[model samples]
Target: MTERLMNTLETPCLIIDAQRMDRNIQVMADMARNHQVNLRPHAKTHKIPAIALQQIEAGAVGITVAKIAEAEVMAAHGIRDIFIAYPLVTASKIERAIRLSQRIELIVGVDSLAGAQLLEQIAGRHGHSLQVRLEIDTGLRRTGVLYDQAAALAAEIAGMPHLRLTGIYTFRGSLLAGKPTLDIAAAGKEEGTLMVQLAERLRAQGIAISDVSVGSTPTAAYAAAVEGVTEVRPGTYVFHDRMQARLGACDLEDCAGSVLVTVVSRPSAELAIVDGGSKTFATDIQPGTEPLQLRGFGHILELEDATLARLTEEHGMIELGPQAQAANLRIGDKLRIIPNHICSTVNLHNHVVMQRDQAYKRLPVLARGMLE
Candidate 1:
């Protein structure tokens, strides 16, 4: 059967274009290889072993996860090297981390001495050493230590008998405030350079800094050029969302994923409701950028372009201009939506159907809701 024929069998399901996905992966991999930076794409985007293996085969050094359960899923699939970008503090989670370290080469992020001490004790009791990376709060004031304090944390981790200081990592996501693509890139490069400088300072202070990881899809293209950054861990680039497009980091054509929903009802002359609501397209809003007023949860892809629109729980409210609304959009017709944030929308589904021209396949979202 043709791909469209098969797609009719799966309604309200995510359909991934395999060819497009492969192309996106190759583009990023080629970029990293050409720039001579290690590529460790975050697996949290797809959260499927099949996609993860595809990335690995395309030359990913390893995979980055946000939770211990995600690491466990990746490890079960024989992903030998995994890095949990977030810090693990609880005793049960620390024990789980220690156990996972025995099976795979694991690296956990640390920002505090207390967290380091807890992990060190767990590693000591388990008779195995843990690899720890100090997270530097370059610009994103999330879960990272200040650059000056990074060296101190590195020193503490280095002194712990059961923990080994491997490198420094940072997420330059704070650069995505507006459409300042060049400014964001410059800021990211500066932050990465400072991170490398701090790493060098740690080395001079008798601390061994092996890896310097920096990433943010908005900043990946430029951050890779930073001198001291050894690896780039961009995750959202794989599925370029509307936000990425607005930031000029990717073209709309580079978006490989979309929500397939049917027009359910048109109760007014100026508005139409789509079957996809908050449950399908997610309620995440993309901030407006000059030259493009983005005011909704997603952009409706027209034949040649797209328009911004809002989403409700069970319906999508699209405000159509006179010429745009005049186009005959009958009930039961399907439309594709480029989500504002691909990662958040993806986590809402259980499986993603794959298609390319006339071929079709189905893949389970193996790591959905593994956020513990």
Candidate 2:
């Protein structure tokens, strides 16, 4: 589409290039197939059931979500197989999971024995048997049982009456020895090796460990190549972000999502203000981090020399480079910005504009705020 056409559309809206997105989906699907592992792309990134169905049609065996509410939304939209890759610790959430299991094939992630026992109690009351995956901390250190205690915890969870322990999974980025590293290949190899070894040990103890699920977008292919890994859960690859590009996961052109905002002001010669701001783009991945060293909130597609330096609630501050001044950015001029993190940035919008064949269509972000 031309700049004139983009300017005609409303400001501060997400624009997704359908063709680029489909290619990303196909590439990841083929990568999982090539490595002989099931592709279970995490729906937490897109959160739209329609995209989840598209992923399923492209060879994904199932989808992974972060919240029970997200799973509920997807299940309501005809998605049958799902993995709630989060620990449900409360009676209400566990009861909801039990209810969902009756209608779909659900796999819940359990890191603590207490969480599993609660699930067991709720499912038993409902006369249901729930399948579960033990979350092992292969090194992210966010949630999940530590590497040393996984075997013992797995044994305990397996003994529960209503919960069946079928697999082990982890979500770790490029890390070496529990510290972030730039060598994604090595990090992915180690992640796969650790999970596979633990699965073998669990099997030796008479536990039925069928699945060794692992991998993020950066490490999916590398981790999937390991001998015993059965599934991979990669979410961000469907809509590549600036962080993913810097991590070497995808090229800049591979990114399909961008916020279309209009230039609302020019306070100074080098400073240009946009309609979208902190509320518009995600700030989780800060400008300066060790490995990636990302320097901006988002990347401006039209002006390569301009930097999105700052963001308030409703304003994006763009610092123009000396060479970019010739472009003469004026008020009402539209700019396309690829955010640092697409997943969080997506949640902020009520709907997104899908651009296909030079045409635009609005689709509601159905699961945008299903945080519970």
Candidate 3:
């Protein structure tokens, strides 16, 4: 019989079951391969180089990072292909980008002519050409140039010396919340279609838009169906969070990452305190028009069905549900918590403990707190 793995961890530690993680990785890889789309998982979900290597070895084309420092870290770990999926500007930053290009294939997102020009100058000075993706504001409205202006921006990026306009990218994270009945798949398809239309318009204007990347765990399933999208960059699909769960992207059992906490005190009949707090969990609430008011930082996993009842910063309060609470839970009893946002929660810890049955090992979060 296989030994239970949770018995070995200390409180307030992030524990990842290796088997579960491999399954998640394989599921996404198979999905992308079967659908004929490139899998470039966002490394921001788990900054560990070992995990990133596992993803690459499992058939991911490359890795995605949100910051220059993260790219630097991954590059040090020998990850040769990286996509910085955020709009970047600044002489110093562009210089760093140019240097990174020398070490690995680098792709940065650009939404404005000014940003593109800066990158162009840096690349020119370094005697290097850089790959860039024009971001389109496809209803998300957080970043990217206006969809109508995408062609113009592409033209500018294409005209710049030492800079190549690779394609376009967008985040459908905005669609993850709202009435559970909302069809995010349809919204994702529409967003992708709009991006493809813009890319086609750019091509008509004599600009070569070679790649179109669209992603969000909620919409990745349908994103692959978008006619013109060449690659899907869904990060959270590897470790489904509470938001992903609510969006119907993954069942609770599919969540591979959780915070291990020990019950410290039962302050009141309605309140119980755990060792994990904001320091362990993250402050990022769910995304939507009326976001789910997550009461605490993270949710307590009810073992029977992996349901979470309530959350607080330092304490995860459980509302006794139909299934009896595990009688094994007592003072000092360790419980696993499914975080609201796996990416941010993972960012909080410097290391993650990997468990397989009765054996446990530690892996450095290698790129933790690399916010630059």
Candidate 4:
């Protein structure tokens, strides 16, 4: 950002570098293209319709969202092709999905016969054939069905009166077996291989499996390389975070979104407090986590010798290292902090400041808190 523009901003702000973000988007798009896999970047990361459209224009086939409400928000903003990556169980939610499917190219996820049956009953009554992707448990162990039961469940879902099982997907971060590992390529390749093999098995049984989608930002690149995989949905690449940088997904310079805050207080030579805290940054990607071993709430760009050691509702405690103590920092100094998890941090804000060259614009976080 230009210094003149920077002086006009308020403290505890969310700023997105448009040029860097566009580069990040294109890089992911190019990766998918080179591997011949569809790039369906997840919209859950930014939750901004403008950003989603930017990704689509860059090369994304569509956008993937974690909730139907988010899909609705995206669709409202002229996003036609969407995948509800999560399973919708309630009748009202399925009804919403059915309504959404009527207007655009909609695909929902199904991991069980029960979920699939509910969709079938509702869609059948509505006289609509709802398209779905079978979510198989490749090892994330969250919402997907077990690998052993995938074939049976998929077969059951494929036979449903109003449901069409056209694809299978799994979301496993950089993990091997069930444990996190630094070997992202191996984990990604494994994810793609598992999904592709499962798709082949289902196809052999005349199930007409078409899309074998897999991957998050950490795994999208390698997974897309696997021959039979049809699509990859990587969310965090749009604004690479500290966690992604540690995971080797991107360099720290690649991080495009950051919290801009002013030094609020200086309690001691080693302790400088910022205007942003838990209310400004995400707390989910906590410090001292395994695998990555992230040490702080965020990475301070200007002060590499300072750590965002703690945060309350509106106070960020920056523990200045020995190198930082000699710098003689003062109050009212602005600092840009790259949060550990930009996606969650984004949910806490109503709008983000987009910067390109010296120009700036405020974009609403339209899909924020659309958890339902």
Clashes of each: 0, 0, 2, 0
Compose the digit string of candidate 2's lDDT tens values, residues 137-224. 9878789999999999999999998999999999997832468887888888888999999999999999999999999989998999
TM-score (C-alpha) between model 4 and the true structure: 0.98
Candidate models: Cα lDDT each: 0.79, 0.91, 0.78, 0.92
Cα deviation at 321, candidate 3, in Å, is 5.8
* Candidate 4 displacement at residue 258 in angstroms: 0.7
Least well predicted 10-residue stretch by lDDT in candidate 1: 174-183
- As a TM-score, model 1 comes out at 0.93
Ranking by TM-score: 4, 2, 1, 3
Is candidate 1 or 3 superior in TM-score? 1
Candidate 1 residue-wise lDDT, 1-372, digit = tens: 243653475456676777778888998899889879899989888898778888989999999999999999988988988999998999899999888988888999988998888988888888888998988887556788876777767887899998888888988753443333445577667757877889889899988898989877777767888887789898888878877787777888888888877777878766667777788875555436443346677767772332436666767776667765767677776777778888888888898877777766778889989989
Work out the TM-score per prediction.
Answer: 0.93, 0.98, 0.91, 0.98
Which candidate, 2 or 3, has the higher TM-score? Answer: 2
lDDT of 4 at 327: 75
Minimum summed lDDT over a 10-residue window in model 4 is located at 173-182
What is the RMSD of candidate 1?
2.4
Estimate candidate 2's alpha-carbon lDDT, on a 0 to 1 scale.
Answer: 0.91
Ranking of all candidate structures by their lDDT, best first: 4, 2, 1, 3
Q: Write the per-residue lDDT of candidate 4 for residues 232-298, one digit (tens) a residue.
A: 9999999999999999999999999999999889999999999999999999988997777887899
